[model samples]
Target: MTDTATTAASAVADATNLVPSTKAVRLPGAGKLLLAQIRYQVRLLISSGRAIAVGAGLPVILLVASKGKDTRPDVAGYAVFGLTITAWSTYGVRLVAAREDGVLKRWRATPLPRWCYFLGRILATALVAVLAGAVTVAAALVFYGSHFGDGPDTQLTVTAALAIVAVLLVGAFAWAATATALTSAIPTVEAAFPTLIFIYFPVIIVSGVLFTNLSEPHWLSTLATYLPAQPLIDAVTHAVRHTSGAPFLPVRDVIVLACWAAGGLLGAIVLFRWEPHRSTQRRAARIQQ
Candidate 1:
């Protein structure tokens, strides 16, 4: 009986040895994950042909075709326009599409933190916007002889240059954050372009983005001055059109933009969703039950 028990024990041990042992797979740290996500998002944004064409190509073409003797304001306006296209329209559309396609849903299931994913996307959009805006500015300077200032008396100092760079950086992130928050309103990828265009074109026209609206009603012009685009354009215009040693920061415009950014960040935190619209609706229904 003892020999039989020993043989049974040996058989059990052999069976255990035949089975493969499981290894503990170590997950990457959050910092590494965030860096990887940011790099991936940057590559995705840079490869988007539509974003490039609309945000960079069209503006550069307009700059080339412009016949104005003073192209400084035009350069600034177009640079802002490029930024809006990249940071707002393109970014918003991509977010909505990702949610609709379940990409965001899948990402939410991963061990990766939600904020890291969003921050990566926002940073990538801002970087792309800056690149597109810079291309527009450079094209104007190289092709149109557009200077930062209106005349020789106006010059770009180191401080003023830094201010301009800061404005671009801030505006890019602001627009991107605003776009992310606004994506909650978009139900489908198909609706993104129409919705964004309806919001964008009218604002640009009223805000004097494409041209200086001199003949417009006084009230309309005043209203436009308060919109987001106008403030950005105004800030850029001030930076480019002012004399040497002039204040580059437009305090009122900066305040308005800051309000928008704060509102956008708040909205994104409150309303952002990871699931597709249909799934979200079903979840809501279940909760109501």
Candidate 2:
């Protein structure tokens, strides 16, 4: 080749070198992406009428409904945070919807990390749950004149409240993780809704907080001991009663709930997939064609 040709070729190569990378150069961290997701989720939570009722309204109503009697804060906790679990379970459904709608698929094509996506959901849900819990607590204190423990035991009551809040917060993250795993396996949002109902309502009904005494020795009551919700409630209740000088250890209950949380998070990380299920349908249809 001539010297001119060589020079032209070299210029072309250098220009190509400067043509910018197609491999998606990632900046520092996924923190901004995760924060954006959390903000969007918070807006979604606040805008939904159902979410308002479930995340905030229900807690206050349940607290006021107790009507100045022998009020169990655990019952209030259940009403407030139980629906929080249900709401976060809907996070799983959102995953299904997003996948089916191609939102997750598009996101997967980006440089934003996977953990940030799910972490945003968990953090957002936890925030809403904590808000609901705060409302319930305020209603208990102001509306019903409820007390965690009698006078001269203020410090113990505060300790119990903190412990219960901590349990609920951890449980929220667990519910978010577990529900993500469950809904990810499901192909459609419609199916996911029913699955959530089947998973949530049965556990709520059988927790024995609604009907039977947890102290009862029946097999169903015994079975409740194995579930996460019941154990959390038990732990909080023990904390409350312990404030009144009762000797109680919530180790068994806290351990059970913590195990559930950890197992759920690990399961979600392993089992949840962002890929759309429609790929199989498309391939099958093409084969038929």
Residue 99 in candidate 1 has what lDDT? 95
lDDT of 2 by residue, 153-228 (tens): 3233666777767777776666777777777778877887788867876776677544445465588777877777
Candidate No. with top lDDT: 1
Candidate 2 ranges with C-alpha deviation above 4 Å: 1-26, 31-36, 68-74, 80-84, 146-157, 213-217, 242-249
Clashing pairs in 1: none
List pairs with backbone clashes in candidate 2.
none
Top-TM-score candidate index: 1
TM-score of each: 0.81, 0.77
lDDT tens string, model 1, 218-272?
Answer: 9999988777788888887777666645577899988877777777777887888
